[model samples]
Each structure stands twice: as C-alpha cells, then as structure tokens.
Target: MAVLKPLGDAEMDERQRRMMDAMLVRGRDYNVFRTMLHHPAAMEAFLGWGSYILSDQNTLSVALRELAILRTGALRRCEYEFLRHAVIARQHGFTDEVLHAIAVGDRTPLTDEMAMVMKAVDELVVEGRIAPDTFERIRSTFGDHTAIDIVWTVGQYSQVCMFLLTAGVEPDPDVADDPLRPLFA
Candidate 1:
C-alpha cells in the first residue's frame, strides 16, 4: 500500500485541487502528483526544475534524455518510474529492443554512442559519478552543456524514482503497458 494515499477530489482542499488540475501527467493527475499534493509548495518547487530537464531548455534531444531517464529508473528498480518513462520513450520512437535491453542489461539494442550514454547513467546511479573515460567521451560528443544535462537528467529521474518507491506509489492506469518485460504470468 502507498505510505501516503493519493488524495481523491473530495479529499483535496481548494488549493490542492487547483494544483492537481494544473499538474497533469499524461493529461490526468498521476498518483505521483496526487501523493505529492500533500505538500503543494514542495511540488511546485519540484515542477520548475523538473520542467527544465524535461523541456527543450536542457538541450539534450528528447531521445537522449529519455535514454538517460530509462536507465536511471531501471537501475534503481523503480517500476513506477521506469514504466512511465517507457511510455514516453516509445512515444519518442525507442524500439522495444532498446527498452528491453535497458531493463535486462543487454547493450546490443543500442547504437555505440547511445550505449555509452546509458553507461554513464549506470555509473552515475551505481557509483555517483561517471568514470573519467566515459565523462570525456560524452563531453567530447555532446559538449559541456549537454554533458551536464545528462547528469541533471539522471539526477532528476533518480530522485523521482526514490520518491515513488519510498512512497509506494502505484502505476497510473494509463501507463500500464510493459513490453520492457514479462509475458503471460
């Protein structure tokens, strides 16, 4: 069960209702936001930084950003986070082959440069810093700004993953597909 249950419409105060109405995920209030509405001020603060990483301001292509997010979520074993990003990734043209590779540690599904990027996310998650060689390669390819964006992207999603897992947030109904894993149970 969720540590803090997501508030239903009736449970929300006017302020939370307004926040919920404004903070749509996939066009509806996701459980993450519903749960987060318990502290609207904090959620509002999270939104600004989250929006930047997710917006065009970050300078990483949507595809590259999603790649970093998917890796961080998977490495963290954050089912909620990984599944949601899986939806975004597919919407942006990530193949099932690539998604499965991320879920299961297979690199064959990615391009060489893309695989290197994922490796950086993996190191960042597991080691808290990308190794010097990986850092140099990414800096050379993506430039200083984008290289930092990759770190920021991973950091953002990883924090979200921790929140989801720690709070025991459930997956939204709209984000239920999981070609990234499993078949008939």
Candidate 2:
C-alpha cells in the first residue's frame, strides 16, 4: 500500500473534489495527483499544465513518446511511473521485447530515431547535457519544437519519479512487474 492513502473521488477537499470529479468523468484518476494532494495548489498547477502537454498537443507518435517515457522511468528507477507507462508503451505498439530492452536499459534494439531519443535521455541522466551528435540527430529528426517537448516530457516524468519515490507511493497494480519493483523489494 502507498504510505499515503489515495484520495477517493468523494473524499477530497472541495477544490480537489472538483478535480477528482472531472478526472472520474474521464474514467480515470490521476495517481500523481493523489500523491501530490498534500500540496493541493502545486498539484493543481502541475496537473493543469501536464494535462495540456499530454492531451492538448503532442507531435510525436505514441510509440516514440512512450518509449522515451519508459527509458526515463527506468533511468530514474521509478516503479510507479515505469509500471504505468509500460502498459502505455504496449498500447502504443512497443512489443514486450522492446519494453524489456528499455526495462534493462539496453539501447541496441532501438531504431535510429529511437536510438537518438534514448541517447539523448542517457546523456541527460548521466551527464546532465545532451551530446552534440544526439542533439543534432534529434533536431534533424524531430525539429526544434518537438525536440524541446521531448526533453520536457522526460524532465517532467523524471520529476514525477522522484516524487513517487520520495512519497513512497505504491506501484499501480495493473502492471505487476515494474523493473524498479525488484530494487524496492
């Protein structure tokens, strides 16, 4: 179980209550919000912008986006994020083999475009800067705006992983074998 109790749809403060209602009507709950509820204002601001990024406009294909997500999740060893995005990656056409490669942090199976994305993420996590080659490759492949979004997406999820770990949030049950779970266990 999560160290913090998840706020139920009917069991939130008025502001949160409204947000929860909106989320439920969309047939989902923001697990991130449930954890971020301790700071309601931050939660609202984060989710407001986050929803826009994830839903309002994204140019990358779902497969590419989710691959980037999974790669960053694994790099951070964030179980909750990794597990949730694993299924998303699958839904977006990543096979078990590809997901497994990401889980184990292998970059060999990735296509040129995917390799460029993973290389960018690896450089950021390991060195805090994108290498020149990877940057140019990403720029050539995705252009400036999409490249910026991809970096922000990875950074956002990196922050999410940090939050979930520090908050001691439980893994989403739907994905039982998140690669990070073994570390926590």
Candidate 3:
C-alpha cells in the first residue's frame, strides 16, 4: 500500500485533471504520478525535470540512461522504479537476460561501454563518487558533457527510487507481476 493514496481522475481539480490527461497520452495514470497530484505545484516541477531527463536533450543514449536507472532502482530496492523502467528498458532493446544481470550486479557479456556505465552506477550508488579510472573512461568515451549527464542520470533516478520506496508507492496493477520482481525480492 502507498503511504499516500493516489487521487483518482474523478477526484482531481481541473488543473490536476489536465496534467493527468497530458501524462496519460504518454502512458497510463501511473500511481506515482497520481499520488504526486496531491501537491500540484511540486508535481508540475517534477514533470518538467522528469521530461528533460527522459528526453533526447540528456545526451546519453536511451539504452544507457535506462541502464543507469535500472541499476539505481535495484540498488535501492525500489520495486516501483525497477518494474516501471524495466518495461521502457525492454522497448529500448534491453533483453530479459540483460535486465536480470543488471539487477544481480552481473556485467558479463555486455559491451565495454555498457559495462563501464554499470560500473559507474555501482560506484556511485555504493561510494557516492565514481573512481578516477571509471570517470576517465566515461569522459573519454562520451566526452565531459555526457559524463556529467551520466552522473546526473544516475543521481536523478537514485532520488526517484528513494522517493518511491519512502512513499511506499505501489506499482501499477498491470506491472505487479513483472518478471523482474523476483530479482528485486
């Protein structure tokens, strides 16, 4: 159960309904977004930043970005984030085997680029900073701007997982049985 109950469509004010409608165009009324509607102002700001993070403006490939996000969710044990992003991750070409490997901290068979990104996520999640060698690798492969974006991606998703866990947010009913569930468990 969520610590804060999600507001249903009927329960929303006009502004909140519009926001929910806009979000629905992209997907369903995810419980996290619905719960966020309880505070309209904060939800507005969150939507903007969240949009940019998932957009092409972030410089990282969608695959890399989702990889970092999945790792963060697994590390934090945030089922909502892990399950939700797992769907998107699959759309972006992450196979089930790769997703499971990420959840369990296995990096074998991944491309050098992906392995480095996973290593960076691990270092950031566990140590709060990327080691120098990892930092150099990221910078060299993707450049300084992307290096920053990678870190930002990891940090942003880390915060998201923490919020979902702390709020006790529930996964959407449809995704509750996501295959990734047991990995997190």
Candidate 4:
C-alpha cells in the first residue's frame, strides 16, 4: 500500500483535477503523477521541468534518456520507476533484453554509449556526482549538450524514483502485463 495514497478523481481539488485531467487527456494518468497531485502546487511546478526532460527539447535521444532513467531506477532498486520506464523504453524501440540489461547493469547487450551513460547514472545516483573522466568521455562522444542532459536526466529521475520508492507508491494494476514485470528484481 502507498504510505501517501494517490487520490482518485473525486478526491482532487479543482486545481488538481485540472492538472490530472490534462494528463488523462494525453494518456499519461500514471499512478506516480496521481500520487503527486496530493501537492498540486509542487506538481504543477514540476511539470514544466519534467516536460523539458522528456520532451523533444531534451538534447539526448529518447532511447538513451530512457536508458539513463532505467539505470537510475535500477540503482535505487525502485521497482515502480524501473518498470514504468522499461515500458517507455520499449515504445522507443528498445528490446526486452536491452531493457533488462540496462536495469541490471548487464552491459554486454548495450552499445558503448549506452553502457557509458548507465555507468554515469550509477555515479550520480549512488555517489551523488558523475566522475570527471566519465563526464569527459560523455562530452567527447556526444558533445556538451548531451553530456549535460544525461546528468540532469539521471539526477532528476533519481530524485523522483526515491520519492516513488519511499512513498511506497504501488504500480497501476495495468502495469502487470508489461514484459519488464517478469524481470523486475
């Protein structure tokens, strides 16, 4: 059960309902977003930044960004976060084998860039900063724009994953059929 339960439509204030309805219209009424609506002000403020990080505006490729997100969730042992992004990663064309490999640090199936970025995610999530050498490697390979986005993606998603894990936010029942569920650690 969730320590801070997600609100149903009826439980929301006018402001929260507006926010949630916007997502519902977009087919993104996920449980974490619902749980976040408990603080409409905070969630509203978070939306723009969240949008940027997930939007076309982000310099990193969707596939690679999802990889870092999966890695962050994995390092935190956050099932909700990892599993949700696993589905998103698949939609972006990553295979189940690749998703599992990213989540569990099995880099053999990943590209050099994918493996390197996942290692950077580990540094940010577990040690609170990316190492200088790794940052240089990222910058050299992907350029400054992407290198910075990787850090922000890992840093932001790590915080969000911590919230989901600590709040004990249950996955939406619909998530049960996701292929990643079987491989969740």
The models' CA-based lDDT, in order, is 0.85, 0.75, 0.89, 0.86
Q: What tens-digit string does per-residue lDDT give for candidate 3 at 1-185?
A: 67888899889999999999988998777998898888899989977888888899998898889999999999998889989999999998889999999888899957888899999999999999999999998999999988888888988888788778877899998789888787766
Give lDDT tens digits, candidate 4, residues 95-175.
988987887789899989888988888888878888999999999999999999998898788779878987889878777
Which residues of candidate 4, in runs, are more than 4 Å off? Answer: 182-185
Q: What is the TM-score of each candidate against the true structure?
A: 0.93, 0.88, 0.95, 0.95
Candidate 2 local lDDT, residue 79: 75
Displacement of residue 89 (Cα, Å) in model 2 is 1.1
Q: Best-fitting candidate, measured by lDDT?
A: 3
* Candidate achieving higher lDDT, 1 or 4: 4
Question: Which digits, one per residue and each the tens of the lDDT, describe model 1 over residues 34-145?
Answer: 9888888998999899999999999788988998998888888887777888888999998888888887667887988788888999899999998999999999998989
Number of residue pairs clashing in candidate 4, backbone atoms closer than 3 angstroms, sequence gap of 3 or more or interchain: 0
Ranking by lDDT: 3, 4, 1, 2
Q: State model 2's lDDT.
A: 0.75
lDDT for 6 in candidate 3 is 89
Give the per-residue lDDT digits (tens) of candidate 2, residues 102-184: 87877788887887788788887778778887888788989987787777778777878888887878765555765445743
Comparing candidate 1 with candidate 3, which one achieves the higher lDDT?
3
Clashing pairs in 2: none
